[model samples]
Target: MSDSEPRMIEILRILSAHDKPIGSKLIAVELREKGFNLGERAVRYHMQVLDEKGYTERKGYSGRVITELGRDKLEKGLVYDQVDFVYSKFEEMIYLTDFNYMTQKGNVVVNTSTIYDESSINILKKIIESGLSVSPYINLNEDKSEGKIEVTTLCGTTIDGILLNEGISSQPQYGGLLKIEDYKPIRFEELISYKKTSLTPLDAFSSPNRTSVLDVIETGDGIIPANFRLIPGVGRKRTLDIINKLDHIGIGGVIGISDEGRDILGIPVPEGMVGIAIVGGITPFRAVQENGEDIDIKIAEEIRNFNTLSPITTKITYHLKPVEHDIQPKISFLLSKSWNLIQQVNFDIEKRKGDIVANVSYLKRDDLDETLNIMESLYNDNPKYINPYYKVLDHPSDDDKVGIATICSLSIDGILINNGVICNPKYGGLLELTEPPLFIELISYNGSTVDPHKIFIAKDMTRITREAGSKKILASFKEIPYISRDYAVDLLDTLDKIGLSIYKISKPRELTYNAKADNYNFGIVAGSGLNSIAAVREKGIDIHVKAIEKLMPFEKMDRL
Candidate 1:
């Protein structure tokens, strides 16, 4: 690549980041932020050259746009390689959770050029057939940025590494797998109306196409408004027909919903039948063969009773999966384009016995560099441990990157991408409202386990709950991920609305991520656990803080 190629790639990156067109002046501003010293005039010259080469299209007063060719270059890792990239903006974390969890248990390491390569389908089947667990490795290069001289395999690796090693590689990316007939796409508007009809997230999700181990029984009549086809479609008859056909194949279920949810969607209403809008979410049962082999899907449920929804953002889940492919390129592209943004984020790393728990006060999709540093530090510091600790990265972001990095990092177990404060970038981002965090964990690589008690999350949870009593404490305010601060004013106001005592919890080490749902579940234990008062009475405040600290360093414990 030519020397100017890097600068051109940067321009293309900026253009692709935002949905709207951009101008040379704006591009110049971004370049300056990225440590470039040039003025807008220099950017204009570059833009002109890029325009001639069909890399960008000038949109009159709006600005320039990256063309398909430019996007191809960026996606293909020409001048702007996805490997060793940084990011500030990102898509939802749930996708990251899916990518990481899906690949972590495999024995083969399949490397796909892009997320769309059809080879993943074959690779997955091969894993099943060979009965070998596999891990998909992205980006072949190592991150020597942390001062390591050897070119080790960080997380992202080139396809050549796959071909050279025992790993597998497909031909250069042609396109995504042809539309798999497994799922039938329903109208978006219909689904939206269905959600409004249910009024509950649990009831709403039950209507989607999914698979699980056990079928949920409904509390009332199982019919949901979405279960029936609507508008330009047939109604109950179609849904019944589909359900019957699916059941005939062994997928047994009446109306699609949990027994309790049945009443929520259909039974509780006094009005006439709301009818089914769609008939789906049934997983055809696989009868065990003579060898007793069968695909047994395990169903999971969200624990909300003990979980507290707080601050304005309330919840950020990287736990959800099966995101649409059309929106995923940005999930990967987000970090590569917003490298500077990643540097602006903050996080802390701690040891949980044999695992590393990283609690990020705030994060975004592009800040991957910092996450890698933490993971490598954990791995290097404890060489005695076979694989070190089961690595965990937890962060909140609008578009997420830290967890994505940790998820893709070497020797990691699983991760939950949390969304922090999210504000429209077009609106100048949190303005002057962002608050100085209660604390900032300096990113440190190469450190021993922070706390010996930080072992299996269950043991820690048991200790916390036993010590905790009836007083529930919620300490937080609404704030954007890295831009603005969420004020304690909201927290105080909330406490006033509901009578409650204040108990401060101290945060000393890295907030640990113990459960697959641990990242979010810890918030529940801290915010709404009935054991809070019992723990206070049993252990007093100092010990209480230490007890909780074993699981996580509670920043607002002092406030409580």
Candidate 2:
């Protein structure tokens, strides 16, 4: 599929998606609304070709409807996706992205990457403004309560929503906006921009991963503090560029950008921390000079000179990814590949004065290759080990294939444990009643999304919990599921390298779980879900019909 696939696929999609047939004029209108310039005649011609090709059908008076064949073509040709990219320097980027992190108490800390090129801001601004005007879905926050209905552009939005358009466009670099030789870089702000996703040079961190940058304040004369130099990504050039831009605008805010960037200025934090960041890619301390104020730079240079003389310690935590096929060979190859890739690109995979050692354990590897491949194809991005979704899967069931397929279906990294069958309320004598089997395969590596690798039992239940996992994990007063282990064994093996620790303690006082309620379902509790409905049905409540009867009142009401 080339650049034209989007329009052609969209035509098939809109036609097949509609309940009734749509005319060529209507299809052209839909395409134009999504920023395509195709006219009615061109659309009609495409429709005729599609009919000739058995991809669409045309009734005498009615217009076009997509055939099963056409739908298949559309599905294969165009894929829908949402993804992120990290920009390093001009035309220098690799496959990487960040996830929305949260604090232990559960607040959203945005995951963002830098655009390196200052000139890209001009491109970003243009895209944002234009997309804001054209994209009817992304920037709308309708004040439905207003007396006078005046449609206008939206200014603010909550953080969870994506700012990209729902429609397909004619743009070649539709995923993001970028300019490169023999390639076009996607500027995401224009392609699928979000209101909460937009930021300027003034945006900076307040706490490591606590506050939102959009909440930052402005100084006088529409200028805001942009002291962005402090961040590792900003470096010196971005700081200078930001300062020079601010100087031209003249500030009413901080006389210049402050260390807070736009995070804080004259503004006071209302208080309380909200989000958390993973801080992966752990490494050992090393000496390096960084630019700063003249005196600070001198001190940093001197410190580096002194630091290099000090003996260094090396640390390596191999993720030791497992394979469905060739586990040993893959592990060997991964280690060898790591070493080879290091020396091959002169990446300096090692430092001085440290011997690399291995810590082998009961291993379970999470290879998110299939999901990564699908996403890469959809976004037309490069394929690597980059994953945005991770999991903590277990093989509690005899169905190891289900267990394997469950984790293989995520967008990130994960753990795989063969920890027997999961427990439900109804039946459980060994695995659940006595103590849940939490035998973990303590493999090492880092990535996103900690989906459980084991079964939640039923496929429906796993599906539901997986949806809930995406809801929120860490938060204030957070209580994760109970673990059966005595030590912080899994946490120490996995997250310890990154300096994160889990406080897994035992019950100070324990009560023997003697089978006290034999009739928990009937005499005492009505049970958990549909069974409860069945119980109520036994009580002559007719809950099955009652539930639908309750909705009749709402369905009866018409226009307000």
Candidate 3:
């Protein structure tokens, strides 16, 4: 394969990343950003070659766009050139990843897979809980037309991205199956060097019959997919520190790491380099395949926000078994009884404590039961939107005279995420009621340990329920990527149909009411799910509210 082929592939990639045509001059600039030394003249030369091959087509003087053939060629380049292209692409994705571990924000790379049969979800859940997968977090969306469920998992490349952000350079070495004994990784049983394959090595090595991940989980002895990497010896301590930090934040994939000059598992390392092995995110898919279920997976598909994923358990919350009958009939009475409770305006602060206490007790006993029953009904209806934490709470906390759990506005982020939209929730604040609602107070979601909504409420920053017809209320603003505007619109509409609280969704590069969005992103304003809870707190009622509490299935939520 000629060296120029890889450069052409890069051009195609740049074109694919954008929906508009691009000229050679602009392409050269983008290439320079990627550290390529290509100049405008050099890019034009390549463009001519691509044009002759019909891989690219010139559009109305706007320059050239990659054609369908170009997309195919980019995806499957010259076989001999693939190894270099694959590894180079890995580095490029790392550079593209903007996820900041410190702020707990930005996008991390992920692997997206699809399973057609609904029955395999339970098996996948077992694999995830058994710790045979990369991260406990996952993203799932159903494709009704294709009758498939798409699953997204954290790619091992995310570690490299995080490491790069920390000023540490990591070199991807290979991907293979690592044997395990007594729950400890023993050695690599099979290996495919990243520098020698056009395909993602982990994806290449994964096979239903070839892997024994289920056995590993059950017997503590078997094989699972793993990736190998090398980092400068001096960075071992720092690397471990990063891994520790990731673990604390619920992001796990690094299975094992070796000391300087030592081998990882049974693989030898360079003299001054340490070897690191990462558990492959494809393991869950492999487990499903091993169970004779049909599945499709794309390894290291793209970069996405670290916060976008939910625990794998959330995906299986409602679909684990078949329903014997409709639950709507069973829950209809409860829904009727609690309809007013769900739709009640913020409580009156002037009410006596005894009266408030009685109301709280009634809401707790009746509303709570109705909420759980609604979630169950939802699980049977549409499990994807249910919150995962509701299963764990059986009763209100003793300290909290009133306990209320509302679906946070951040749940919109989750919805957008599942639909391939990377939504960054920028602020949780008081949105003043006016001709155009304006945010008077704002707190960033990044770098905050506590939910900003909770902090605002605790600080008494809201006047949502101070009056019977208060104009001001709590709300949140999120940034949606410009390219995914259409997807976000449709998904937001779906949320509205389901009765989720949404205030405004801005046009591309526009403000939503008064919430601002950058040129590259659109803004979304959603009423805080805790608006009711906040009103209760305004009354001096001892109510505890949790925002973005947990990933609960949509089915579990009953709209107030």
Candidate 4:
């Protein structure tokens, strides 16, 4: 916060960058090179001030080495200096990247982080397997200190170097948190333009409160550090070719490549330029830090021989078998949780702004029949969210008149409960219309006081149409105990035969098309019973919905 604080921080930073003590004369030279306009005497004066503050200590006849306090001060440095430091650091790294993918030779920029805990390394391996890092290749070495492990991961900007090697000009853009679902990229949830920030986006956003890299590895739903870059349109073809080559070598960090104007996730791109999202190289280490392990992260730490690093293999195997637990207590817990869900839906409906019923049962009087027709046509066309049941209400409100109650996905949990199995509904979100549909947004049922599905619907996020494989539809994510996977799958199959819908089910302890479940629980994705109503809303029709309105017997409801 002081005028001289930035300069002092810079002096500390320069000392910290070296492993040995540096003298005032050399410090003066470096300062002048950085446009500081400071001479040796002035540098000595600042060094004396720093020494008095116990930030630096002299070693023999050598100059000064930054102390632990000095390094801490550098970390909490001024934003102006930090930003300038990061930008210059990136420029230097880009200039240093000389690795050639063709011959697989030369130096490539890498990031190194020091971890003290040995157990947290497994978390890093899992993240790499999940493809949430810049590359699967890594180098691990013992630090000078005992019990410290130095992890080297390829920096995302290494791609910039590779591009430059092939004469392709590219610019690093923003570093941000990219949302991942079903182990695939959806969109960026947060971004900080590189030019505006002092810390690398990965370093700035990799905090435990900001990233869920561990959760993403296990459950496939979380935000991870990723960066955007722009390249000339003319180099797009060559750049992709290089990327493919990198992948063949077991190195991958590319999320998605966009065409000329804008990216698929709606990130902007300049004309005649292509934008790309790449997983940050240091992302996997967030798992270590998130687990409360102390780590020192160095972005663009140094260059390494491309051949020296080894491809990351599964070093620790996770036992995916189901654990034995008292099913009765879990059943009670799930039932209580489901009741809370019902209550939340009711509360949300009460506080809802418009004439929204906020459930799956009813629609407006005018669009009820038309929406039912659309649902029928949709089922006839694709057989998803197929419910033939409907009943007209004797008393219709101005908005909630037509009653077309489909079986809410929550009913699946009820069925699982009846069979003495535990099913916990986790999140409600928009499922992208893809070959293997991935959730693009999700809000946890337990964390939120409102119905997540209702919130997404009210925000106009639904884009479901009759056309296949391109938009998002209303869906819910749930997890059943791994032990109940077989019985639950059988129950889901039975419901599917009876016109109830279940979109996907994960393996005993694996992800369901990248959507993650609990630690030992398998994930199940089901179409929201509100799909039909949401589709009608997408048609520009004003409709009210009552999601999970009530639990009516299957036989009591009649076919339309």
lDDT of 1 by residue, 313-427 (tens): 1122211112132221111211122222322323221211122222222234353444335434533542221122122234443444333211111101111111232321100
Tens digits of lDDT, candidate 4, 470-558: 77777888888887777778878776666656888787645454356658888888877677667777887776656655545454455
Off by over 4 Å in 3: 1-6, 35-49, 61-63, 314-560
RMSD, one per candidate, in order:
22.8, 27.0, 23.1, 22.3
In terms of lDDT, model 3 sits at: 0.66
| TM-score for each candidate, following the candidate numbering | 0.21, 0.23, 0.52, 0.51
The clash numbers for all candidates, in the given order, read: 65, 38, 10, 13
Stretches > 4 Å off in candidate 1: 86-560
Best candidate according to TM-score: 3
Q: Which segments of candidate 2 are over 4 A away from where they belong?
A: 1-3, 79-560
Residue lDDT tens for model 2, 1-560 = 23554577668867975888889888999888656799998988778777888989987788877888887665433211001111111011111111111211211112122222333333323322221111111111223454221111111110111101111111111011111111111111111111111111111111011111111111111111111011222332443353344223210111112232222212211223111111110000000000110110000000011111111111211111111111111112122222322222211112211111111111123322342233234223211111112122233442322111100110000110112211111111111111321111111111101111111111112111122222111100011123423222343233222212121222322111211112111100011111112112223331111110000111121110
Quote model 2's TM-score. Answer: 0.23
TM-score winner between 1 and 3, please give it.
3
Ranking by lDDT: 4, 3, 1, 2
Between prediction 1 and prediction 3, the one with superior lDDT is: 3
